[model samples]
Target: MDALLILSGIVVAIIGWLWLVITSLRLPVGKLLLAALLPVLTLFRRDQGYARAPRLLLTAGCLTLLVGLAMLFHLHPHRFEKLVTGQWQPDQNRSQTIDGEIMGQRFRPERVFWRGDDLVLEEGPSERVRRSLKIRFAGAGALLDDASIALLPNDPGAWPEVIMQWHVGALESPGLRRVTGQYSLNLDFAPAANSGATLRLHLTLPSQHQTWITGEARLDQTPAWLEQVRQQQSRSTAVRERTATAPRQSGERPVARWQAISVLAVLDEPSVVGDAAVRVTTVSGRAHEGRFKGVTDEGRIVLAQAHGPNQVDLQFHPVDIRLLETFQSPR
Candidate 1:
């Protein structure tokens, strides 16, 4: 519908300009160019003679109206495209971000990340109009006319399909606040743990006249992916710091880098240090690769499990401990 409207508008504009040029070419070529290109100037050129002046003025008025009408359409929001259906599937690792689907067919998202409880998804829509139209501007007085609607979709009809920009995570719900990045969209709600392993997201059209899309994804690996995203952010920060101070250490050897590690534990449960990738060994030749939380108090070592957000204080003793080695950062 949008394409048809634009195509027809262009055709009409071209025909109108051509007709004006041929019909009024009896005047000097320079005057004809001025009248056609800058119709408003024709209004001031009454000296061109009253013979064709009124007709030319009338032509200028009509042309001005036509241009203004086109501008009005361009400035307002209009439909862009029609979505078939949408779906999402987990990546090969079954964690991190998932692949997108259109009408049960596989597709891809431009970018994906986790921000707090919401999973962010982003995809660039094929532009029906020029890219510059998406940018909004502001200025004093008439300059404001050059501005655009910030929330307006580049393709008006597919506005609902632009999940990232619109934050359309649920049906008929307000969009969630975007944390960062253009085209990034945050899911309004996270899946409840007991709600089942499969998490379903529904996207409804704001127009309320189009079909809604649903995407079901796995939640089991979401937490792990969230942790990975945080780790990436930490790495990025460190790199930026290194880059900023590069000039000062131009001839020096790179310094050893160490990551901040943490002991993650649930209340009343043993605190786990590192995962399988990292191994911790004791003096007794005992090697452990999983979570192990022991408390040291006075002269005894007490071990227990943990859960939730609570902390436990227990006694611990150093008995024939051999070694405590960590190859990677702890979570």
Candidate 2:
């Protein structure tokens, strides 16, 4: 459907341009030929009278000329370039990445920004959830501005969601144009399971042309170790409360109580450091797997060092409310 819409739009634009040229150029040779051909063709077909034939043929010829010009000049070259290159190059000094977790699962790439290119995200990994992504102001052009990226879940009945937005510059010249925009990924995951996700990238140019690409990856799985730590913390907390309330027996050195409390607190702390195990995937499809240990604070997980070629320092934040709720809920 999208392809059809785009094709139709291009056709219409070309026709409009042809009309403009027909009126402005007013080529007598072309006009005369069209005027004569129309009446003859109409007479043979036994259709309309000779009068209307000339006007209809003239209109069609003009439209054809406009389309020819558009095709020859390729009004929107950037869009075509993207289709061939499959890479978006926005202006310099514009780059960003949005990171957040989906239900405590993993720090997924929520959005990526590079100048004016707005890359939309889509559903790719699991089937349990849907995500919408949008990117605004994809690339610079002569007269085009304002671009967007949208992601729809696999469910055919579901509606599309906007995930990114940015302003595009107008298309005016033929020189190298640049655009910058942010790519944002938005997902609504199922309560306790990992859901699949996808990202869609789009680049639009001045000539009303666009290029689309897609990338996909699974959300990181929550480490079972984290769950164990939480459970231990809960038990320790309960033990402390009971001990605190049980009025310390006459002089029973409060040392015992303090010892127990310390043990409990330690049990609840996460042992993984940014230097623990780390997994890295490069654009070349090569997997460099290692480990890195790091510390987490205020729901943000950060890596401190890389254990190998596949490991790198990265930060992740909890963004999945449902996952957090389930994790905290009594099992």
Candidate 3:
């Protein structure tokens, strides 16, 4: 019945369109003007039963033509070209812009790839240098509720790999959604890999569904970029160290917590330094103050007491961490 109703509507729309075109071409100018205004007069005419059929058809035809035009333009053909072709042909040296409509909203990407879990996009040019942006996805397994991406430092010299958090929904159930708390890229942790080096992203769900996706850089290998950043950091650190070593006339110097943590994480272990410590408060209101040991295999942080003889190791996931603060500059 539904199919039949749809077919009937299509036929009526086609007929109405044809009638409009035929009348516009064949009818005299005076008659064409009268036909266009006849529908408006029908609303006021009380005894007009004979003109009702033509009036209704003309109005319906106009509305259908407007709707058809909207649909044709709204669903842009160029945007879905990559989807239909199943390949991303982007420039090797520079980033490419990929555009599409997802969930009725237009999504444009600085770089593009059809990963296993979702359609991956580099949101901006800054991702090439900073590597600090969430990958947007809207395909396969589930719809994304929210997502955040960050680079986690593994080795001081090596490029930090990508880590992400996604609030995703089940494909089978519309409203049933869960957050993949924190899933880091399960890629080869090599700093010397090329910009186009391939990496894999595996995000597992409570339903035992593991979404694996592939990624590649548009320009500048991870190792090279990090090496350049590290060189600049070293120069900056030297200046800061010189400033610190200089005698102060009156007041004490203040430390920037985040900068200290990042610098220490790159140069040495935060636990090894006497003054370096990070205090992280969890989502459940529990606070843990300790030296930053490192990120675990499961993407959790290893926090150890800075001064205790018998070290207590506390494992906290990225999702659980509410705030992170560093005590002082690295020794």
Structural similarity to truth (TM-score) of each candidate: 0.28, 0.23, 0.29
Clashing pairs in 3: none
- For candidate 2, give the lDDT of residue 36: 46
For candidate 1, lDDT tens digit of each residue in 189-257? 233466423333343333332323345455444444334544554676678578656664566655533
RMSD of 3: 17.1
In terms of lDDT, which candidate is strongest? 3
Please give, for residues 1-331, the per-residue lDDT of candidate 3 as tens digits. Answer: 3233334555665565445445455556665554454534433544533244554674565555555444433443332333346545754554443333223233344554434334344433443211112343322111111111222223111122223322112122221223323433322212224443232233222223233333333323333333454455467558757765777566655534343234324234434444457776656443445676776666666665522223334556567677666665534
Over 2-30, each residue of candidate 2 has an lDDT whose tens digit, in order, gives 33444555555445434434443444565
lDDT leaderboard ranking: 3, 1, 2
CA lDDT scores, all candidates in order = 0.36, 0.33, 0.41
* Minimal lDDT window, size 10, model 2: 320-329
Q: Let me know the TM-score candidate 2 reaches against the reference structure.
A: 0.23
**Pairing residues by index, what is the TM-score of model 1?**
0.28
